[model samples]
Target: MEFREAIKIALQSLWANKLRSVLTLLGVVIGVGSVIAVVTLVNGANVYVAEKIYRYGADVFTVSKQPRVISSYDEYRKFQKRKIIRLEDYQFVLEHCHRCQAVGALQSSTGKVVSGTHSTTDTDIRGWTASMPPMYNLNVILGRSFTPTEEEHNSHVAIIGTDIQDNVLGGNDPLGQEIRVDGVPYTVIGVGEKQGKSFGASQDNWVAVPITAYQRSYGTSKTITVYAKAGSTGEPLNAAVEEVRTLMRSERHNRPGEEDDFNLDTNDSFVGLWNQIAGGFEAVAVAIAGVSLVVGGIVIMNIMLVSVTERTREIGVRKALGAKRSDVMLQFLIESATLSLVGGVFGVIGGIGVAQGVTAALGFPSSLAVWSIFAGLFVATAVGLFFGVYPARKAAMLDPIVALRSEL
Candidate 1:
């Protein structure tokens, strides 16, 4: 028989027992769907992290007193004993680091903001130098950022985020109005554009003030995070980091061969951390999906074997009519593959719909990649071929005389 004829026969068999075919395909559907869903969700989260969490542009990094990833309680305690990064260190970097394009200092505290009866607690009060705005791409939608003189004089001027404007100021014209932050009054100089949530927390629930003013109000004991922008060259970022490290080590009086007492984190560092987390999730998902696929394949193999048994008379008739063994095997193989491919198509659709629904309901991100769909279909088809071999071979080896003698 021709290949097309075999395919038609296989499809006809499936259509004749539609319920059984559907039941057999369930495992494949579930397996493929799980894989696709996981990939889509992971891809979307990676994109979100890159765009929102790492929004400070690629060329910038921050210097802080402690490492973001502390391996143990002892390590955390050791880092806690390190000297806090200060505004003076930021200035030193600006003056001494030639590979740095810009350097800024930031200190933040949580407190209550009050404007008459309207007040909000747990509000982030960030103090930043002039260079912070440019380095962070902090666009002001209303009014303007603080002037150099204002920063130098420790002026009580502030830039409020959209949350502060809406919740405290009631969306009124906020510029030039005074809002008390922890009992200290600050005239509003600007309102920052709305920045969406990161890691399920709102980014807009904060206010920015000059570092000088913040130090005066909130005290200078708080550790300052220093942001540095590297020069526009491939080698400058590493060079700048190295230069800053050397300068910091020398300034802190760290003897040669002693470990530095600060952490330098770049955009890639955060991305790397996210990748590690995401990779673990992906691995677990894939493993679970693999189990489902194995179970589904077993179902297909058992069903195919039963199918061969039920259609013994038909196989015998074909053999009596001069059908070759290869032809019989090919027909069964085609039937198994077609069954799996159909399931794969449905699985892909279901996975995408599920991903979208999850994203909409939970506000989690999901992005379906084309390759994932194709890969899912391919895996399903491969499972069919791999599991169908034994059943197809057994059917092909049946004796025409005995098969015809046997009754279903």
Candidate 2:
């Protein structure tokens, strides 16, 4: 029989029992959908972090007391023992590192910001040095960043985020406006450009003040995050980092055999850590999806076996009419594969839909790879073929006279 003719008959047979075919497809659909949804979410999150979350420029790196991504309790405990990176540390790098182009220090905490009756809680409060604005990509859309002299004088000036402007200040002209941060008053000098949302949380709900003012208010015991940018992005950046590392080691009193006392994190390091976390999620997703696919394949195989039993007399009649054994086998295989392929198509669509729904609900982006869809379909078809072999063989080997006499 022609291959096309066999496929047509297979599809027609499946269509004749619509309810049964659909019931058999549920497992495959669920399995493929889960995998695709996970892939989409993971990929989207990775992209979002790389492009938006990790805003440190190629030549920029940060110095902190601990690494950004801590994986274990032991590591956390170890990091807790490191000495806090302080303003003097920032000054050390600024004054000593010839390879460095710019250096800045920042300290942060969460606090309440108030403007008359309007107030917001859990708002980010940052105390930054004068040069941090450009290094960290913070732009003042209105008014201007505080001058270096202001930073040196411990001026009580603030740069507010759009969220503070809209929610706390009630959309009033924020420039030159007075707002209270944790009960300490600061004049708003500029409104920092809006940063939108990250994973459903507002990124622009923050205010920045001079580092010296922040130290006076919040005290100097708290650690600070320092940033440094190499003038160039290439090999000079490495030399600059090494220079900072050497100075930091000496200042922290680290011996020649000891590890550095502080952490230096770049955009690439952050992304790499994030990817490690995402890789674990992907592995778990694949394992879970694998189980669903296996169950689905088993269900298809059982259904195919029943189909072979029901079509015994049909097979006998075809054999009696000179139908080859291979023809009978091919038709049954095609029917089984068609069942799974259709389920796979539905699964792919449902996965994308679920991913989109989650992205909309959670504010995480959705990214679909074209290859994933094709891979899902191919896997489904392969599962069908693998499981269909037994039933196809059974049907193909049936004795013509005995099959014709059977009641089923």
**Best candidate per TM-score, number?**
2
Task: Name every residue pair that clashes in candidate 1.
Answer: none
Query: What's the lDDT for residue 242 in model 2?
Result: 89
lDDT against the true structure, per candidate, is 0.88, 0.89
- Residues 1-408, candidate 1, lDDT per residue (tens digit)? 576776776678778889988888899999999999999999999999888646777778889999667769999889999998888888888789888888888899899999988999899989989878877788999999977788899899999998889999999999999999999999998999897665456789898999999999878887899888885535888888889898788777889998888899888888899899999999999899988888899999999999999999999999999999998898889888877888899889989988888887776888889999999999999999899999999999999999999897
Question: Ten-residue segment with the worst summed lDDT in candidate 2?
Answer: 50-59
TM-score of each: 0.90, 0.93
Error of 1 at 126 (Å): 2.0
What is residue 292's positional error in candidate 2, in angstroms?
Answer: 0.3
Candidate 2 residue-pair clash tally: 0
